[model samples]
Target: MSGELRVIATAGHVDHGKSSLIMRMTGMDPDRWAEEKRRGLTIDLGYAWCTLPSGREIGFVDVPGHERFVGNMLAGVGPVQLVLFVVAADEGWKPQSEEHLQILDVLGVAGGVVALTKRDLVDEETLAIATEEVLERIAGTVLAGAPVIPVSAGTGAGVDALVAALDTLLAAAPAPEPARTRLFVDRVFTIKGAGTVATGTLTGGCLSTSQTVEAYPTGRRTRVRGLQTHKHDEAKACPVTRLAANLIGAERDDLARGHVLAEPGSWRPTTVFDVTIRPVRDLERIPSRGAFKVYAGAAEVDAKIRLLDEPFARVRTAQPLVLDVFDRFVVRESGRQRTVGGGTVLDVGPPRAADPRHRSFLARRAAAARGDLPALLIEERGAVRADDVVLLTGGEPPTPHDGWCVAPTVRHAVRDAVHDLLGAFHRLEPLEEGAPLGVVRQAAGDAARRAGAPRAAGLPDTLLDLLASEGSIVRTSTTVRLATHRVALEERADDVRALLERISGEHEALPPTVKELLRAGTPRDVIDAASRAGTVVRLSPDLVVAPSLVDRAVALVHQHAADGITVSTLREALGTSRKFAVPLAEWLDAQGITRRRGDVRFPRED
Candidate 1:
């Protein structure tokens, strides 16, 4: 919910006073390893905490100075909130300093402070020249508009200003986010008093004394016996908090920095995953289409980086894929090197396809690495769902099948997909009125969930409206199917190919029973079909088709074609063999469809 945690790391060449500045600021030495002090260079990452004047707590990480520890430096740089690019006033910017800067830039460090150390060793003119050079070097970057402050841990000159600068920045800086929780084991050891304690940055989500955190890659779970941040007990520890969790029944030596700590069900293990990755600068040979180890959370695995677009890229990672894949989503393995770029998993198993739009997305992502979209990636991906952006950006979006970037969210596709099924049910004959929700879901595809059934949040309410508007479906409370797909059947009895028209025409003299009316003699199938067709009217069975041949024949007998007909003579026109003459008399009587008075038949008034 908050922005990001402020975890600053010190990166400077050997003898740049990186350690000394940290010690003076926090009144504590960052050289925790004895080997580091003896060698007069930072050997491993030493963590310290700083409380700014605004009362906000920030973590400071001091990485090693020797080139041998560059790997160690890489590990710490990613999780830190910002970089304090330390340069000695006497020595100015050095080689490793540039390397660190490049790494920071590549990792998208948006906020930094250039701490000009050893100020007492340089004169005013020299100091001015050094500051100008550093300024030029930092142009077109996040630190372009930043202030360059000169301070000596030895003299305390500008120390107050540095603290005040940090105080203001800390208050304004974004809070750290924990999408989920990841605790990478840095060092673990058994203690006489605490039993077993593991130390590392509590980088992801909250951890209290009672919560169980998993040792990842190894798949071990342990409870927090105690917690120490900057060597202080913690009820809840969050981003950049240097933590020593005393875990119950844990073997400290067995747990190391490369191993991870995570909350269960929050973190998972996979052998393959879709990721965005970048090569570290200064490596002479770019990786070919080859396999590399990937580490994420606490999981690690080897996977082939099937480079798309080109075998070699001047860009970092080339293409994104939708993959039904699994691997460590963090900690990419490039040949012999280890990179700390992995953080969260966007998807565990995904479909595969080729997508060129993936490249543009990657380009946009690389351009916006230090800006807003890192958070956007996490939000859209719903991967770690934690707060950190730096860790998960390691793997480009996945490129699965023929290598296309698959949209991470499946809800929209599934919603549209089920419309096909609903449409068919609406338009087709003899279906279940409405298609089964299961059929709708299956037709919707794998990525979608359903809504009405309350199981899958598949098909949202809005989409159902879309279907109705398009006439793709029809509804009346219980039924839902395609608008053009529904069918109405035979609604009339005895309606053969052309039987209905003749029956309607001939029966005009007197209404007939629905059964007898259609009789050029209709059958059950014909009647049922006609009934379904809605052609015949089923008047009561009483009034026969030949109402009274006697009355109508008598009436017709007196009439010639030129003369008007009378009802009594029409009945006489047909004798006992009335069947033949009956219909004819009826017809003549009904030139006006006939009229009747008591038992008499007459021609009706036209």
Candidate 2:
């Protein structure tokens, strides 16, 4: 059937007919392991698929119902949106059934159907009692108000009605958004011909043949050699479908269960995550600082928990996990058999707080739990991508510029700091044009820290350009200054101006060098001041000339353009020494006023 594909995970107690129901529905046995078939117990994840009458393809992730294989169950359920919760009618509700329900609630699974299996083994009155009990147990859970269907796989009774119910459920469930594709590998094996194969329920985005993917935690790169969905080869596979990918570039030993295959650079491995956890209400004790087993998206790792305010905890996994914001996880004590608690990941990689119990730290984390993405951006004081915002807030993509989004408040703060730094620089060194950009940035960081504003590592070029655009700051290739800033000569103003004027009047065609000015008893500071004020121009380390005299030299060269000019000829024409005329000739050539030909210079044609 060429219709929408959906993945549905089955959960219940051991020996509750989960596999039997899936086999009956899909006509393909889900149990793949020989040991599982011999023991008549599902020891690992199984897969099957069927096409509904309405043309919707449904994939089933059959999980082990025994208490010990809960980790496997979590792997299958973590990535699937729809669940088929099974409870045997003859047995009513069992201990594993309650634990699975708790795990589902903690994981925040929002949609599912509660199926009452083994109806043929119970009488009508007994079936009614079992249905009532099942309904009551799930009254406050994700399955509350969900339709409970009584079915018997042996007699094939109510199977059609179950399919009809699933059809309706699939119709109403929201489709997965096209994001970065992630496939949490629950099973890894090698075939006779194929090199390595990994299978999981794909989500977040789509996968295509020949695309490059990275195996997380190990970071080994691989390419997709082939793709299959629902046992049919496909060129591409989308989210909410069971996928098997033949991979190249890695051996079966290199990949294993709990490793994820994702689009290159789409996900990062993280050891620390900030989360808001809700302990199972019937839990005997609150989760505390201790070693625990964490199950998230087909990953099981040992982690330690440290509480952060109420409903929040910082979990540090023993190994890095490929996770994103808002991803759900289940936590069990190191030696406990039941789930202790679970929560949504608030920050995949959180910063280390100086004092985690500090009021400000707690407040910021609380805001993050409430989906305040802008607050997180401000705290980070950096640019983030639209995908990050979506993952964190569960909201639509925000409009971004240059693929990175920065808070306006952060931009304004940096601009203000730059302006303040420029002002201070002008006050400190008025004779200098401006401070170097690096110095200004350092001063801005100090200012932000002093003012209790979050300190960014460095100012972004985009923010700097934005500041320049606002007319508050002027940015050159190397320096930054206030727009209104100007170099003010504080000493020898009158003497420098007088000296420059006399030099220009006496030497109209040529200017004296700084050594000559110094030999004339003019102070070094006076000559420097004159140059800084633009009254005189420093053409080279040894030559300083008045702007008026340089113009006169240009005219003299133009007058001799027909014959061309040389340094010696210009020296004779200006009645100046060769030492003074050589630098002048080179300056004119550099300025495009004259073009050099061998040892001669010609007036520029243009």
Candidate 3:
């Protein structure tokens, strides 16, 4: 494709020459770990970038096929857009290949170019049979319609065709969506002259130096020391380019395969997963509700399957759970001990506690799939990406046993969740107007689900409209406030009218910033709420002039300057802190009660 971003991986059982084939194809080494080259088989994930015949360079993540290192495989392939399923013609699809392929299918790795390595080891007929067997294994799967080619890593028989096919596949790859930011970390090493450097494909999202970001699971925050994309130093990196970010603060040991670099708060760690999972055909029987090992993203934990309607088991983690699946998840259990068949993630955090007696989750599960899982996860969690959804869901993305519309309902849930939050406010403190939109949105989502809204989208607008119309909503010139609650600095509706009387009379020339008044022991939220209630107007970011005080201040400034109120006059006039003095003058200028011309400030009528 003209502007495509390609991420491919190598898979097959160990000893199938996945590393050698890569070496032949790109002339780049994949065995960086000392033990890997010594063992003569890849025991970890290795990464490289190669240019296709078309001159389009793409990233290739080489993962281990050994059963012990499957977790490592999950991390490498988690972010890839394509796969290079390598099955030696002699060995065919072995345990490692099947497992890795199953993971690819579960992780939703689509568009693969199958390479039948070691073609020289077998007769033409044997090669055909092995190739046929490999095809049959992947048939009806994501790797089903993938292109297959034969090769000899030793003789380079079909290496040329493989590269050509890669070129064609990459040429047809779709352009990476710039809308959602994504980064896949593959290499973390200390530079000889520099410090810690992380190399990976910048799938989406932009990365630049001096930007603040956090490393997940570890909770270590750091700044980008420098950025390099496509082997060239850059001030910032755009999506779809291979990136090597030099990091500051984090020790080299603090980073690992499972560690994710993301925008702060964009991705969180999740325990419970509401997933749509499926049982492999080989399952001797369906698993009952109880503990089973769940593998996702880069982590795996023991979980209990809470099968729904008995259509599928509901998986419960040792802690809070978040992966969701219906009849469609690729779930495999070996006596409820380990997860062998992993499935794609549909929705990360739905209700695992959903009463299996009713068809509630079943009703909305299908919609979540067709609707878009990535969109759904971000909408509900306020997280920025599907990985965050993965973090929220507690696993890699869940593959739907059936289709779903997780996105639309999630958006609907946000509107309702924020609204009902207001209803709660109306009850707890009827005198209080409302809260901020961010807080409200989160509360509403939880409340809506609790109220049997089916999904977030089912929330009613009566709740949302009430918030907006009531002016209960506080807004920064930038952010929305459907959920962030506020209170006035001064008592409202005549609560302790004496305080306002004093502020109005004794301090006519100046006012207090909410922070300063808050020092007197009033809670910040309560102060903000009162301000929004119009008991007091925040004439400036810091300055708060009570409704009763504005008039006297106008009269006094006119008395003192008549011409204008300079900084010194205003400071001397208010006995308040500097925090309030500068802001009070600015507020006066805004009210059309005063205008600042050059160094002198004067009062002016609208």
Candidate 4:
């Protein structure tokens, strides 16, 4: 079985000859369990394969048709794209047949062939009526145009025609997309000496021997020790086919039917997601609340639904599942024991609240095609790391900027917010040269939150630096300011000038302390503005002096060439107390104008 591989699942009611039809088509027994063989009922899934007349291979996944085993049937058919719908000619249409049809339609099965088996049990007139009933039942379904073939496994009649019809369906089927590798495990067991083995339909990409894969929901890593498709050994097996992989790193107890084996780190298991759900064809309305089980890719878990808007809801699963956007799923009410509705996954990560902006984002995702979703994510998220975009969408981001995927509109909004915040700061604090970097960052974070994009709060620093490099803002070592922002004296010009004159003249040697000036009716803003303008120098938080006085002190320190000056000598020269001289001398040392050696000070040499 080479060329190309296609998988098709058999679906119908119990005892409708689904397994018998597969046995006739492939010459193999589909009822794997002994109880199933004795009871003549498919209790679980079965597998068989054969090559068609066109040299194309087809794998058959036989699913149980009993209403009690619908969960088993869903696991078998969830990952497949085509179905071999069976409806016994004598039984006509049963309850299970309609349920199976609904499942296939919601799963997005592309095309199929309806097998009206047990042809010998019914007369020609009866068979004609039964076929018409099936046709009417499938009027608007995905299999509306499918060919209905009458076949008898006991008499071996019409079997050849059924084979030919399947060949035609396979020829017209679209080629599988080359996506990341994903295999849903419907069966997990330990093969004597080969360790743990998992079997399921591989749909995403190809799997090669020795490839590393991770089990989802558990995140256990393992290596594919061996690969087999239809019991034939191969180094690499492509998708859209049934595969049995021999695994090495996990025990049989660690893996289960609902678990998934995927490429290492390629998938993120999620507990909550947004979806566009619709009630089953005939059902009027689905339950808005209560526990339901979500079935997707051979996995079923208890879930709770919240209606965000019409046909859109948020599903919170009891257990994490490896689900992606656009993946089809079925929701069954556990209490009623019926599939109420099904839906397409729209978002794997949704905000906590269903705000208006979030609702609009979901609407766009629902309307856009698969390839256009990544860009929509960027637009809604405002900004995301480039690598994260790939991990989320399985594709490169659209028009990345500086290694980040960003929306231009949102970026512009954040920039405007930054400018407004800076302008407000300047108006309130004209004495300060600029806002502290930490304060600016806090403002940027607040602005981002107001813009409804808190995840992009770290983006402000990068944008701020970019703006500074482009000459839009002035960025210092510790502060940020608009290019046009400047500290202005304004109405306090005369007060600041008078303070500067007092510091350089009468109080040149021992300038008034900052606390004293404030007590004498000198506004702190005026004193701060003069200090920022270099009209006065601050030796400490409480001390202020004239620059001319500092120059004189430096000259006196260098005059003592033989030895560095002591604090007491500096206090005598300045005619001030130790409080002012100690801080002033420390300030000179900090400025590299003089060096202190224990109790002495010396002029620094360049």
Which candidate number would show the highest TM-score if scored against the true structure? 2
The TM-score values for the models, in the order shown, are 0.60, 0.90, 0.61, 0.80
Backbone clashes in model 2: 0
Candidate 1 per-residue lDDT over residues 1-606, each given as its tens digit: 123335677787778998999998988888987888788888878777777766666678888766666667765664555778888989888877766765665455557788898899999999999999889877765567667889999988988888787766666666664345766666677889778888766655778888987776566788988788766676777775667789997776557666777776444443434344444444443366554544332223455554445321211222221111112233345564544233223333222442554444444443463344544454343332222223344233332222222233443454467565565554543324566545554554343332112122423333344346556665455446665553343332223534554444454344444556445455444444344334442222222233243344444444543454543344344333334334554554445545655544444656
Candidate 3, 243: how far from true, in Å? 3.6
RMSD of 2: 3.3
True-structure lDDT of candidate 3:
0.62
- Candidates' lDDT values, in order? 0.56, 0.80, 0.62, 0.86
2 versus 3: better lDDT goes to: 2
Clash count, one per candidate: 93, 0, 86, 0
The sequence of per-residue lDDT tens digits that candidate 3 reaches over residues 1-606 is 234446687877888888899999988888888888888878778777777767776777898988777666766776666788899898887877877776677666647899999999999999999989988999977888778899999999999999998888877777754333445565689987788987766655688888887776566889898887556678877766667888888778877654567778665454544445565545544556544666543344566665555343345555422123321233445353334455444344555455642244444544664335444443343323334444443234443211222333443554555545565765566445554445655565565455343443423233344345455554443334444554433434344243354346666445445566667554545555556667566766555567755554666678866567776666666555555666667778876777788868876754
lDDT of 4: 0.86
Report how far residue 22 has shifted in candidate 2, in Å: 0.7
